[model samples]
Target: MNVFYEEDGGFKVGAVLADNTTSLQVEAPHGKRSKIKAGTVLLKFEKPALSEFMEQAQHVADELDADFLWECSNQDEFGFADLGLEYFGHAPSTVEAAGLLIKLHGSPMHFYKKGKGHYKAAPEESLKAALASVERKRLQALQQAEYTAQLTGFSCPEALLPQINMLLYRPDKNTIEYKALEQACHDTGLTPPKLLEKCGAIPSSHDYHFNAFLFEHFPKGIEFGEIGEFDIPQDLPESNVSAFSIDDATTTEIDDAFSLIHLPNGNWQVGIHIAAPALGFGPGSRLDEIALERLSTVYMPGNKITMLPDALVNAYTLEATKSCPALSMYLEIESADYSVVSSVTRIERVKIAANLRHDTLEPLFNEDTLARGGPDYPFKKELGILWELANRLEIGRGKQGSNIGTDYSFVVKDDRIAITDRKRGNPIDKVVSELMIYVNSRWAKMLSEKGVAGVFRSQFNGKVRLSTTPGKHIGLGVDQYAWASSPLRRSMDLLNQRQLIALVRGEPAPYASNSEVLLGAVSDFELASEAYNSFQRNMERYWCLRYVLQEGINEASATVLKENLIRLDTLPLVTRVPSMPELPPGTQVQVALSNVELLDLAFGCEFKHRIELQ
Candidate 1:
């Protein structure tokens, strides 16, 4: 006998092979045998063949209107056979019962299944809401298909334009737009940024990379909000000597300056004057909070986000002709050997006599010019004296002060980039670096000696870190180096300056021994400083690639660092050449450049020939 049964939420017709009261062994129309419960068997028939039963039943189910069937049923639960009998106005045929069951099971919005074959009509309101949801989903599917087509066709829909950054940076996976973009990316074998760029959604590659960084790091935006002003300190004593600053022309946050005074005992009193923003605001102040949040000034090739507001930077930066409040460290050096005889730290306002720029000063103050000692310029004598003292300080620290390699500086103007290289350990660099290192080391030693907590930059076993505890910075050849010089640029410097100020004033230290605040600042500053430096490096790399493209150069010179890895000679760019032949490290080579992808910050290159050293 043929039996119509419900299995796995569907109706099927099978021929019974062995019949049991509780369960039956039946062979389906496809000749597949399965064991079924007797309760799951909804109907028993004999006339129609098993193959013909389901097809005919499905036709009948399709012909029936589910809404009409729902309307005909009562609110109380009833079996499908009973409903079919009531609707057909007769003892229902097996096919009619199976078809009605099929319709009732399929149209869940109209009727909800209760038991094996029993069903109940859905409530009016619930059925309407369910139907509306289905319709909305259907429409959304169509819209998603449309967006997918547009994206795959290299056209961005207007709806997706406003959300381009969001889609690229932080995507909501559940949205249809994101799903469409995801599908398009999969179809085109491209990333979200590449696909968006293809669709004309990305106007500038530079902005794309820059904006992604901003989105991740500065989610609230780079602009400083309504931090109420604080008064600049006015009661500080002014220093007797005039100070001069040497920095790049682009520098506006003039952190550290220098002063020279000839003392009576044939000695020189050299002052390392640091711009003291800590004087204007103390711990827990609004400005302090701002500085702590930013941690350090974020620098790129052509731009920077200052740690403090422009107004505060202006008030504190030791600009030329301004008597800026400074945390000055004075070292009395005996003229015979340029050795420090005594050292003292004080809070004073120092007159900035000049802001010497590297571009102007390097021409007159470099190694060759200093050795010749003929071409004289403003502050040349002071710079010479400082150079001598810097040498003495370097020698005292047991450092040979070797020039490792070239340091590249990038200047961007009107979408054009100029990458210039300066040899490391130049006299200007040595003087500034040595003095800053000395001052930082001195302040850190003072803080440690006074039992005050401060953030220090320490290096041990080739690893560098920030800590409240004092340790040796083997790289700088210093016992303990706290960043107390660039108070206008770094949060650690500012915090260290505060501790040093309190210690020098004989007042209670703002951060006590093992203070959580100091420790937390060290941890937080390390993380932020690394992130800022990485961003700076990436932006520098971006501009290096920009400079290459801007100059329309095809062939370039490179020094191989490892197998297939090369650094460009003219710019600070490092890339791999897959087509390059195996070569040793430091081998110079000529390479042909092609396919520069700014979005990916990558390029394709082929090695041409080895360049022999002169």
Candidate 2:
């Protein structure tokens, strides 16, 4: 006898081998044998074979109308055979009963299973809603297919234009645009950015990278609207010294400058003046809030997003010919030796005499010119005096200047670039760097002595950190150092400047010790500053490759940094040269560059011959 039974909540047919009272030993159609309970047995037939019965029942199930079956089903639960009998208007054959069971099992939405071979009809409302959802999804699948077809042909669908940033930077996988973009990427083996660029969706390669950064960092866009008007301080005592700033020609928000006064007592009074914007913008003010959100100015190869608006920067920046409010550190150094006899910090208006550009001044005043007594130039006398003091300050630090290697300044204009190479520890660099370091260290000391809290830059054991407590910055060979000079560009500098101004003016400090705002700003600035610096380095690297392609540098020399890593001689670029022979660091090797991908910001560097042996 052939029996139809349920096993593991599924229908199966097996041949009974030995029948017991309540159980049977049966062999399945595939010849596997098992003991079964009598209660699990649904039917027993003698005529048709088990294999043919299932195949014929499936055909009948295919022919059945699920909607019609659902309508014909009784509201209360009934067995499949009873429903089959009700629909067929007769006592169902065993095959017909099994076909009804198959139909009911297939249409889960139309019918819900209650017990073995027993079924219940779904409610009309739920059935309609489920059908509508399935139909909508089916239509969306068809639309996705159409969009993919358009993208496959290098044509962007109109629907994807609105979601270009989303598709490139942060895609929502559930949306149809992203689905089509993913499918197109899989088909073409091209990245989404490349595919979109091919379809003319991306206008420029520069914008592609710029927009990605903006989307992640400046989601609302880099705009400062209606932050209120800024007031330039009018009632400030003007200084006698005429100051001049040294920065790149493109710099507009000039921060630090210098001045000199010959005292009658054979001592030189030198002023390291910093543009003081903190005096204008207090904590929780509009400009302060904007500066807080920005944290620091974002710099790339050719452009920058300033922490302050142009109007405010123009007012506060120590522009030439303007008597601007500044926080000055006047150092009284004896003429016989460049030692700080005394130092004073005060807030006053200092006349900015000139804005010296590196391109113009570097030629007149450099290491060679300083050693040989330069051909006459603007601020030559003042710079020479300051250069002496800078050297003295460097000697006081117990080290030469922070000498590493070469530093490149990038200038980009209308897609053209110029990268000027300069040595790190030149006279121009030393003078500016040493004075800034001295003032930062001196002001850090003053703030600590006065019981004022300030954000200090501390380094120990090769790791750098921001802390409130005064500690030794072993790198600079200083007891403590804080950034208080560049308030026009950096928020932390602005914060420290606020504290220093309070201490110098004998006013209550703005931030209390261990205040949440102070602590949070320290940590937040570290994270934001690191991210901005990394982005600047990466963008500079991208430009280096662009320079390679533009200059057609096919073969170049590089010094080995590690096993396979090399630093190019002409460009500030580091890469892994392929198939490099084992060599020690500082061994120069010739390399061939090829396959520069701007979008990927990568280069294929091949090892040539060793340029410098052992």
In model 2, what lDDT does residue 494 have? 95
- Report, for every candidate in turn, its global Cα lDDT versus the true structure: 0.89, 0.89
Colliding pairs, model 2:
none
Query: Cα deviation in Å at residue 402, candidate 1?
Result: 3.2
Best by TM-score: 1
TM-score of 1: 0.96
- Worst 10-residue lDDT window, candidate 1: 396-405
TM-score of each: 0.96, 0.95
Predicted candidate 2 versus true structure: per-residue lDDT over 411-525, tens digit per residue:
9998977888998888788889999999999999988888899998889999999988888999999999999989999988999999998887788999987878789888888
> Candidate 2: where is the Cα deviation over 4 Å?
6-10, 18-25, 34-42
lDDT of 1 at 122: 95
Candidate 1 regions off by >4 Å?
Answer: none
